[model samples]
Target: MFYFSICFMFFIILFLMSFFLFILSIIFLMMDMVYFFEWELVSLNSSSIVMTFLFDWISLLFMSFVLLISSVVIYYSKEYMSEDFNINRFIMLVLMFVFSMMLLIISPNLISILLGWDGLGLVSYCLVIYFQNVKSYNAGMLTALSNRIGDIALLLAIAWMLNYGSWNYIFYLEISKNHMEMMIIGGLVMLAAMTKSAQIPFSAWLPAAMAAPTPVSALVHSSTLVTAGVYLLIRFNFLLVDSILGKILLLISGLTMFMAGLGANYEFDLKKIIALSTLSQLGLMMSILSMGFLKLALFHLLTHALFKALLFMCAGSIIHNMKNNQDIRLMGNLVTQMPLTSSCFNLANLALCGMPFLAGFYSKDLILEIVMLSYMNLFSFFLYFFSTGLTVCYSFRLIYYTLSGNYMGSSFHLMSDESWVMLSGKFVLLFMSIIGGSLLSWMIFPISTMICLPFYLKMLTLMVCIVGGVMGYTISLVSLMYFNKTLNLYKMSFFLGLMWFMPLISTVGILNPFLFLGNFVFKSFDQGWSEYFGGQVLYKNLKFNSLMMQMFQFNNLKIYLMSLVLWLIILISLLMI
Candidate 1:
């Protein structure tokens, strides 16, 4: 517990240092200076494994933001986990996660990046299971194995990089752009990113990971684990530009966004709802990156990190006051009972919905405008706008259920915003969520965006927001009526509620066949054929040989005499011939 305080101080210092470095990096970017440092640790014939670090606006700025969020999370956890006996373990795991994120950010070599990537997967599993419960254990396994798929993909990528005789993939991005090996590596990298970012088939784990502690949820879902994929794509954007694989990524990301948005609408758990929103935002980032808008994706990634982390913290505070109850249906009128938390939550929700000039507005608006400006297929355009509307719909539904609806829980339960430490973290993030987008857009995108679109297309985002918000509110008002009327589309509702059966696909679809095959092999080989041929047959043969030897030994005289007579007869016959 004492060490927890030390960990908090350490992160605070790290945040300050990273913030200072971010300013310097911005100056360097402005001056058109690229800073790279490399040291060759081992060299072979035409091959070298080098330790490399890259300092650019992207890495530095992202690192700074990561450290900022981490510091706040640590401080917030001090209060959130105050009553827990294993606070030290929790804080340490978070610090380790932060270190891995920093390593992933700085490394230019794929081999080196794996150290950080695997570290994140490992530490996140630890954090997810911090509560030591059945639910947390299962969630941890799902999270770990899902991320293991990405780790394997990265390993495949590293193996393929051997063809270039170098592990520093950054140097080969342009040279191997047209090469088959690079294409294979690019596809594998995208798959790896998909798993890490919870895209499509890998999407179920993100929402399930809400079984973790809220601070861990904030860190893992907001920036550290999930966004690692987006950061990887941003670094590899040079190689992905105009590639066929990029288009595939665009399609997958669009689907992921839509799936998550729909799932969030069906979800009742407050934390899970926020988790789904993070998934949706991650999809948005990946889609934008796939379209070659690296800067825009990065901008959204940072701003989303700010608001999403803040959002999770606010959710944590509310959950804490509500005695660990997270069902949105059980909560209501929190705006009056817990004014500070409700305000922060509402503000973060608005930011998430891309309202006006909030942090989400700048990046999401730019992304939509860019999508409209570009020549895209109708599917991509429809997915982009539809997912956008879904985001608003879910956000409004969540707000209505948790903040404004009549309080449905027991009145004896005490709810208040008394934890200053928790509120302190939210306050810091609240300020950022409000202004972080405009500030980052200014710093990251110095030039004004050139947009020329029809009037309806330009107002598409606003219109969707309005329509979605109205629908969300209206549906919430009459939700009981619909619930009582018991429709025949229960299967459809179940499918949407379970994230389009992605979890089933990932778990049952993947494991059932293999489990069945394993059972078959075990029964046939271990119990039947292998038992007959290997153990039973060998035992029978050995027993028969032993019986023959025993008979020969017991009846030795008669057997010997007969053998001699036969030998004599055979000898006489040979001599006559």
Candidate 2:
């Protein structure tokens, strides 16, 4: 009861704070007001260390959304973590995560951003390993180390920024595009963002992080861990949009989107599928931002946060009711038992597919339309539309597996919709998922986006969604006959299902050489040359000298008399000379 009260208190406080922040953000947006507060900690010759806070609409709105999601996730945790012995610890970790996210959101200074960035990496590692199993430990290490790459990148960026004599990166955005040092700083920042966002090469950690508890999954996937990179890039768009690095980011992020979408279609794990979808969306945000649609990327980022958080919460409810089994193949016709959760789940799934006027439609459709309008290569165009179709295919496949067919799990488990506390936590996000897009569209950019395109081009998004849905439903209906037919394609399926061997490359393939080299170093240096020359050999020399000295110390009058005669002869020879 005491722990429950603490959870409730946090939820209430965050809810109130978010509410206030939202209102303030709206006012700030309407008035075009940006307030900057600076506290100088040190003022040295030609260098000042200061803590700076930027209260523009972007930071305020983002902070509000993050706090809102964190509060709800905390509320949901009360029910989900009710049986855990250390619920308070979980709450504290979550609170720490929120604080770090807020810090990242508000800072315009590179040094301060690194502070928050490091905070995020540290706290998320704690959350990932909260379960304390081998899988969790591996996942936590992967997540931490992957983010550490970005942390190092940010550190390098900060160090590079020192050449500018101040760490406030905002003042240098326009200047960054022209200078070589500024360009390097931008690249470093982009590298950090890519790692944090789990873009290619670093993609292994996002799904592996599913080893964490569902509540942490909700928080991490939604607003904190993965999005941190996108948010940072959003801040650094000025430096990237006009540079070659921007084009490279677009290509990489587009590939990431396509890879994630294809992998999700092949995935069986429920949490992993959702995590992949988040990855794909992140790619969309990055790709779009690289194409110079900053507002669209930010729009998608905010909307994605709402729906993804809701989706994870719904997944948690289902997982809890189904005895924590996350295999989608083992779940079917869950709507019959868990109506509310199923409704929210289905809502999120459709939103992800960009169906009609749901939260995702406004932003996702606009993004696709803008991509169509952009002058880009056919390869990039194919990646955009094909990835969209793949998203719907996987979403529908998930729906058919979990919500359409007869119940597939054991008959003994009683999946119920009685997790009211969890449901209550979900309601805010559910409502937001329905209207958050339009609401943000109205609030952020009052001036509407204008588009003039051919009818066929305009309808491409809907066409892809429809076809993808059909493919999803059709292919998911696998009978024994279907199984036999696909048996010949086992190798292909395995390749696609393995995320094109990305996880293998990231883990075993990348680490094997380093590990082998470490072993060689251990043998050749620490244990071989080092052990002999500086260790064993030196010890043997010291021991031999000590033994010789001890022998001289023994009672031996003959040896002492010989030594005295030699010394006296030396003295007489010196006097005669």
Candidate 3:
């Protein structure tokens, strides 16, 4: 126990160190931005590799959110992680994940960005499997493999770009601006980005990933992994602006938005529902960014990091209090008991549902504004239209399931609200949910008014908000009524889960046939070996004859020796060649 305490303390110390490093990185980013904005290329040597400037307006905004979300997640994990569940390993992986995400955000070069990208995915896999249990291990493995497929595409893009002596992000930016290589490497990279972001047909692993602990889910879905895809898109937005493939990306993002949003509406698992919700929101952000509404997408990303992390952690707390019962149906009237958690989750839900004056409202409204202005694109129209309704449905469902149902849990003891360490983090996010938008709305939506939105536009947004809320409320009432009498609506809403399984279905033949053939071949070989060696007859004879047994044993030794000699010869020849 004392040794475990020492290990745990070591993790705490590491977490603090990471926190300090993050602060320092943010300061450096500010300095980097100033240099990038004002400095000329002629002023510096070409080959120098010192602390370099990487900031653009997008990177600067992304860095701020990355730092802020990572800090909050670390703080929340300090108390939420179970001491017995390899807490030290969890903290180390968390710190590594944060550091990698920071590197990704400010990465000046594609090579550097890929480094961070691959590293973040790898560390997240570790976090997912921190429990060292079978289910977690399998989930982590699957998630890692899927992300690795995306990683390979990124590597291919880097290789293609480097073939032209372009190793930096500026190559792609220049290509976008100049219309160079519009269809090849650019398209490949976009597909890679989609896979990483959990876009349609590739989103199955994300829900499965909820087998991880809630903190890990929060980290994965909130800012690090899912956002990596969106960041890649934004980073290459210049190249994507007028490209045909880029237009297709807009369509794909829109489809993913509706599919994942609706998928979340009927999930009973707390973490899976949130995971799908994150994917859906990411799709919205991606769709906006794909249409060149960069700042609006980023603003949504920032607000999302704040509230989504809060939701996941509070869900973690609720799960902890229930001794890991993650079924939302089993959790009821928990808000009155877990006030701190309830407050944070409710605040996040408000933001998610785009309720009035919440951070989600301002950020999400910005995206809607962009979509409205560009309503000429039929894809955009359907994307935003379906997304608005689906977002409200799932957002309300997530809130209603966990805290609004009649109490149905077994006799469960309630601990105090959450630990001070955890509550401190939750309060920060809750505060952000309430005030972060209005305070930074101008900075967040730089294309709009710096201080306040135009009067007419604000009024337009207010009308949308009020109408959307009423529609959401009505849908929830109808859902409740239907659920009380039947389960059709619930089952219909969840049909998208079938789409999520497409990948596994496509690969089933490849895997199943080979496995079946291998099993048959191996069984055949075993029977052939046994029969030819007369193993059963030999065993019966050996039981009655000692001489026969000695002869058979000698023959076995001779066969083994010959096999070893043959293997050595083959190995030697291979080595020589």
Candidate 4:
């Protein structure tokens, strides 16, 4: 009873906090209306400390997703986390993540922005190891280490900028003019964003991060932390919109989406599959972000929060009832027994697969459309098509396998549907996923049309969405017939090979050479030091000199000083040129 009351009290506090923060967000959103509402450029004095929420309607929309996901994760935790784990500590870390993210959303200065950015990374590291086991500990360390490399790159970029004597963001309003510095800052910042967002070379940490609870996986990976990198880049669009590096980012993002989607389809571990899917979705957002589709990125971020969270939480519910079995192959025909859980999972998957009327359909299609509209080149169009096809292949892999596979697990009674709290949390997201299209088309675009890019520019983006969805769905169903081989090499062979190679290459390329050379140098120095001064003989000789000096030190200091002056002049004159 006491514990239950504590849980209740915790949520009450969260409710109040989020409500307060939301009100503040609204105020900040309106504070710079002239600058944000009008297309014309505006500047404030450097001395002015007024906060300016600079991101367009898109950023505000993403912030809404962050709040919704955070709230749901907190509510879901009551049932998700075991009592043995410190629930209060987890809750505290989660709140900190939310608070920091909100700060990142509204911060006007680079320093404040970095504070929020670093805070989220730290909180995520803590949450990753909330289980406090050896494996989780190692995973958390690696994630932190990888992100640290990106953080350092970001710091170097900031340092480069600050050296130019501009602390206000107004300086970057004309980023293209300073192409050299912009290239350096933009490249380094993109590297940081890629690492945080888990793009290639840094993508492996995400799958390992599933050591965290399902709720954390769902919340952090799907909606908030992973999407942060994309959010950061979008916020800085003025600098990147026409840069050479921006084009490279677009290409890399498309490849990442395709590769991650392929990886997700091949994965068998339930959490890991979802983890890869999270990466794939993040890649999709990044690809659009690279093309300057801020609205599409924000929309995808929002819809992804709903469906992906629902999918993960539902997976947790399945794992919870199945004694924590994580391999999807071990269980089947879950829909027959766990109807409510199955239904929710299916609905979420439908949204994920971009079925008509679902939230993902609109947001993801919008992104593709934007990319196509923004880039008329054949390379851009082909990349979008290929990535879209891959997205379909993976989304249906989950749908077909989970729903249509044979029932094989032991007969176990289903837990009741998610608690009223969890259900209500998802209910809000589900509603958003459904109505988000009309909202975007009718309201958000119209409002931001004046200040942002025009509405007619979005037409190509909308057309691509509709066309891509149909093509992707049709291709996936047809491709399944020819892909009946049971090798599953992508997971068993390729994934394992990549996993093994990371540490293996790190050791050979970095650690081994350093260890071998360092050991040889240390041994040589130790032997030389021993020969010269390591024994009692050396100590006795030093003692004898000290005794003689004490006994017969008649103006020795004067003689030494004379010799030192002579040596100094000879050394100075030799090098004077």
Q: Give candidate 2's error at residue 203 in angstroms.
A: 0.8
User: Residues 384-493, candidate 4, lDDT per residue (tens digit)?
Assistant: 66666655665566655565556556665554564565565566556666765555445434463322345664454444445555654454445445565534434565
Residue 104 Cα positional deviation in candidate 3, in Å, after optimal superposition: 1.8
lDDT of 3 at 557: 75
Off by over 4 Å in 3: 1-53, 175-182, 415-418, 444-484, 488-494, 497-500, 503-577
Please give, for residues 38-121, the per-residue lDDT of candidate 2 as tens digits: 998899997867789989988888898899999999999999999999998899999988998899899998878888899999
lDDT of 1 at 102: 93
Q: Note the Cα lDDT for every prediction shown.
A: 0.89, 0.90, 0.72, 0.69
TM for candidate 3 is 0.78
Per-residue accuracy of model 1 over 55-134 as CA lDDT, tens digit each: 88788888888888998888898898888887787877888999999999999889889999999999989888888899
Judging by TM-score against the true structure, name the best candidate: 2
TM for every model, in the order presented, reads 0.89, 0.92, 0.78, 0.76
Clashing pairs in 3: 176-239
Q: What is the lDDT of candidate 3?
A: 0.72
Model 1: residues >4 Å from true position, as ranges?
1-4, 40-49, 486-489, 515-577
Please state every model's RMSD to the true fold in angstroms: 5.0, 3.5, 9.8, 8.3
- Candidate 3 lDDT, tens digit per residue, 1-577? 4434543455455446545644554565445543342223343556544333465656655665665666666666666764655666666677688778877877766777888999988887877777778988877866787787788988888777765665665645664465455456677778888878988767777887787777778777887888898887776777677667668888888888888876676567888888888888888888877777766777788788878888888888888888888887777777788877887888888888788799898888766765565544766786677677777766666666667767678875664584777777778778878887775575543355433546775566556546655665566556666766546544555466554454465347333576688788777776667655778767867777987566657768777787789999999999999
Q: Give lDDT: candidate 3, residue 457.
A: 57
